[model samples]
Target: MKVVPLGDKLVVKRLESAEKTAGGILLPDAAREQPQQGRVLSVGDGLMLPDGTRAPHEVNEGDRVVFSSYSGAEVTIDEEKLLILNADDILAIVR
Candidate 1:
């Protein structure tokens, strides 16, 4: 399905959590923390500037990003989980 975010919003697909820790110990579902990393699926048009020129967002499609744990609204699209958040909610772009 095609998704288009409006007004500086971003659509991201959450990455799956690791099944085990660095020590190779299995982690229970309830013990796992919410994922803060995701792949950018869509980005909205640039935000309006005071001078009337739109300032484009730094993020783009396919960019891997990290966000606040509580950021964005969780949504399910076509049975696939996705997040919808404002661009300001994204903390950083992963290398």
Candidate 2:
């Protein structure tokens, strides 16, 4: 299944986090925090402005980005978990 976001919204898939800590201790699933990193899957054209102009998005498909915790909505596409976030929710793009 394919998802096409609209108006500065993006479809992102969360990247998996390490299960173990730096001390080589394994953390239980309940003890793990949700990952803030994700890969951009699909993007909308851009945001609409009141001036009748659109602002281009800084993010693109296949880009790794970091967003704020508790940001965006979660959806299940074809049984795969994905996030729908606004462009403004992204904090930084990973190099």
Candidate 3:
């Protein structure tokens, strides 16, 4: 299945967390936190402005981005975790 974000929204998949510590100790799932960084999978066209024009989004698909930790809605499709968040929730794009 494919996901397409609506206006001003984005479909992102979180990047994998570190599996091991610096000392090479493997970290269990219970010790890991949900990642705040993700890769953009799909993006909405843009936001509609009051002047009846569309404002282009700052980030595009395939861009790695950092977002607010508590933002967005999560969903699972075919066991794949994904997030749907507003473009505004994105803090920065990874270079």
Candidate 4:
């Protein structure tokens, strides 16, 4: 399925969290925290400007990105979980 975000929204695929601690201690699923990082699946065309020029996004598809923990709306597409967030909610583009 193809999803195209409108306006300044972005579509992201969440990265799986670690199943163990740094010391190799196994952690239960319930103890795992939601990851704030994800891969950009799709980006909106860009925000419209007053002068009719669109502001391009710095991130592109397949780019690793970090966003606010509370940002985005959870959605399921083709039985796969994904996130839809605004561009402003993105914190940084991981290198």
TM-scores of the models, in the order given: 0.91, 0.94, 0.94, 0.95
Report the poorest 10 consecutive residues by lDDT, candidate 2. Answer: 52-61
lDDT of 3 at 76: 96
lDDT of 1 by residue, 10-88 (tens): 9999899988999999999999988899999999887878898878999989999999999899999899999999999
Q: Give the TM-score of candidate 4.
A: 0.95
1 or 3, greater by lDDT: 3
Candidate 4: residue 94 Cα off by (Å): 1.1
Measured by lDDT, the strongest candidate is 2
Which candidate leads in TM-score?
A: 4
Query: TM-score: which is higher, 2 or 4?
Result: 4
In model 1, what lDDT does residue 11 have? 97
Root-mean-square deviation per candidate: 1.2, 1.0, 1.0, 0.9
Off by over 4 Å in 4: none
Query: Which window of 10 residues has the lowest lDDT sum in candidate 4?
Result: 52-61
Q: Model 2 over residues 1-95: C-alpha lDDT tens digits?
A: 88999999999999998899999999999999999999999999899999988899999999999999999999997999999999999999999
Candidate 3 structure quality by residue, lDDT tens digits, 6-70: 89999999999999988999999999888999999999989999998889999999999999989
TM-score of 1: 0.91
Scored against the true structure, residue 54 in model 3 reaches a CA lDDT of: 85
Of 1 and 3, the candidate ranking higher by TM-score: 3
Candidate 3 deviant stretches above 4 angstroms: none
